[model samples]
Target: MTVTDQTAAVTTAPEIDSEQLRAVLEYYFDQDWTDGLPVMPVTESSLAAFLASTDRDPEEILFTIGHLNRSLSVRSAAINAALAGCKPEYFPVVLAAWEAIAKEPHPARGIWQSTTGTAPFLLVNGPVRTELEINSAGNIFGSGFRANATIGRAIRLGCINVFGLHPHKLDQATQGNPSKYTAVIGENEEQSPWPSFAVEHGYAEGDSVATMFVIRSVVHIEARHTMVPEQLALDFVNTITRSGALIHEYTSTLLVLVPEHAELFANAGWSKDDLRTFIFDNATRPRAELAAVGKDALSNRTRWRLPSDHPDSTPDTASTTDEPDTVRLLSHPSSVQIVVAGADNAGVSAVVEIFTLNPPREIPFSSSRIG
Candidate 1:
């Protein structure tokens, strides 16, 4: 039988854990789905098909997140991807993201099911974006694109169903941003004259991969012919750096520079570093501004009272230092991330995708050591 046939046969199984149903129904009286209309049961066969496409073994554990401390095996991930309508090729990117999350020891489980923030937003970089047809263009986060939507949904479902991060249960998002369901994947700069976002994270200019982060929201910097390139970038950074940006001093931001705005910078010969540093340095909201936006912990930087003196240096900086003088976030300008994407028509517009950490800079995209 063909892989598709085998997968379809197994995926059609009629099984939904009655216990889980009982639990969820009792909680959400007016839940999204009605009594009979539930999600497809995640089965094993379809999952195997997804794993088969990846170089990793099916049983390989990618990462564990949230309350259940559920292990993300390649097998389980494949099934999640399948349910989310992901193509077989999208598995590796998904797997890599799980790997990346596992590396982020901030207890993502709480983040996934928190009333405070949304789960980590997944961003695709490299050749995988095109090979899978992810939307990094005009309708980028507006839905309607398959790869643009499903890959992100797969991860979300995995967190919700597999990891048991249901709202109020584990996720505590008070006013969590809307980009949670949206794929904020950035397009490659190679397509234009700019260097790719992943390149800033150390990926070669042409590698294919995925990046995941805990993003709060995204906004745009609209510029016109009246605004020069430098002014335009400054404006883009200025616009996105307001209230939500400083909710926490320890965020890794993912910036999206649309083609129209990118061209202006390209014309003026602005290197990636120049843009990143410019935004990072100028994106500052004063300590008072952060507190006004409900980030009371904003001024906690560098003020950590660490047992008198546990060795002092750059850790004394108010930006990266934490309680007890701990250096939890980046101590310098290298903490921000930037990417160039969007329509080339506008001449000076950009879609900025923001993250809590500087984001997935795992160097040299992982190759299939054993496909």
Candidate 2:
């Protein structure tokens, strides 16, 4: 069981009852050890229960966060999960999400410290979603769902405690969005016309999995009049075109569509690949437009350098009169991730862009089983 210097012995955390909880909460707040929310105290019983939910050893180190130089142990994860108000049954999903976070291509420290105020956007798939009662419908991205809220918060708390990406100190996000607190959504697979996100990502049909991505912004779209496939896809591409171009070597984008909106494509017999191809082809702007926005000579400057073959590697120097120089928004068709979620709101969708960097490489989207 390899561990980092920050690793603590597997000892029982101090207990705090309701009577003494407020004072402790105030103490943590005064120390700036919280995400501005009152946390559930990680008592001995809760910690034990969380640890019991997983089969791994409590002292076993899952991954060493490269940027932070911190080793995350199973015990530490369970402690934070208990603090985040997750049920014992939710522990597997929490651990799987952490594994996905560890597998990301970008370093965790850089992402949490970025000025864009990025945070992990989690998407759960398979029967575990229904078993945990995760929200995939109206106000799913908003409040009032425990499975959605705390599970996401657990990951943030783990980053703060185990990995030391504390907000306002190490985790500096200028004007962070509401998703920073919690951004977990389940695919409405039961109602979806297509396969589950897990299947598309190479998992078994019923396998429980969690997909994680470091998202900078989620652009919401409402195409109420899009009754046809082209209309709906064009609506998405229009929004993508208007968004800030952060084309990097690996630009992966997420399109979360409600079942109603997905139905339009299903009716047209279009596949997910078709949707990705359509968006990749149409989500473009003239080179002149990019130049007008001061992006003509922009280059990716991240540590994981992109190849020279990247479409945007060269300066967009097409002649102003040469057939309107066009630049595609997505690097490739596969870069577009299509997940059907939400209920009742037929035309509602969102485009979650990975944390944009100078060289355009953030954490690659990674998924792991919740087993």
Candidate 3:
């Protein structure tokens, strides 16, 4: 049978009675369909509302899990959205996130089932941030906003129910991350000193876009003492280049600058590109340091010649002078994505390590417009 027909066959279920509705949470839990939390019931009507929010065909296949031999359709995604308590309007963002995941260079790499315990970190941009009230400031990653919470949870639920990536099973994380529960945030565009991240990625300023990244870890940086932008940049560089975290040469980072930190850089005339270049040039460790951390073998095995456009790329003719004693943390300047977020009360920032399976090249992220 075709993918559409297969999805339609399994997605159909008879409505439960009111008596059974009271025990819905337990019912789903017993079926091992929940994320170990109370999920909103996915009624037929609610699912219908979610499907109506998107123009895509309900039976249209979004992507397939190659190993599992399972496909997720638009209708299946809507069911998960409803179960996660997302408003009908929030469905598009969830769909956009899946679109981004589908664009991964090697979907069979099973990023969702990595042992690193990576989470689907979402960056929402454009007017939808305001329209959906996705939190962009003050405890942005913390709980409070429904849009940030449920939209993220919807994706997790789909992974569980659709692809069967349950803990200790398909998912083999040594130690899981808490953000695995939900991690979606919007850019504080109104308070940002630089252009919105989506715009930097070449999207129209008015377009609502969702970009997904697999985050291995989040390192919080607090540099309240520094007024100099370079000083603050160095603090971030220190965190990003930590020897223990430098498992592979292809690793990238998402630098989240709080409004207070962003303004400092703006006042110092440091653009995002300037900061990226600075980090790429300076975020390095002595080769001896990697050996001390027992990462020398892995580092030497993973190192490759960076692209010519990379800031630290060395000429083939003069390769002997390529800093044999040093190891650069970031492969390219473009690998470091900078965005403004969080409250302006403190000089705080966060470095999110992007998870990768050491693909042959920089892993491409997906940016889908929210309609």
- State which candidate has the highest TM-score: 3
In model 2, the clashing pairs are 300-358, 300-359, 301-358, 301-359
Number of colliding residue pairs in each model: 20, 4, 0
lDDT of 2 by residue, 177-266 (tens): 788788899988888899888897789998989998888788889889857899889888877667353444235678888888888898
Following a full C-alpha superposition, what root-mean-square deviation does model 1 have from the true structure? 8.7
lDDT tens per residue, model 1, 29-69: 34432112234444566666786786677787877654564
Pairs that collide in candidate 3 are none
lDDT of model 1 at position 287: 44
TM-score of each: 0.72, 0.86, 0.88
Q: 125-147, model 3: which lDDT tens digit per residue?
A: 99999999999998888999999
Model-by-model lDDT, in order?
Answer: 0.58, 0.77, 0.82
Better of 2 and 3 by TM-score: 3
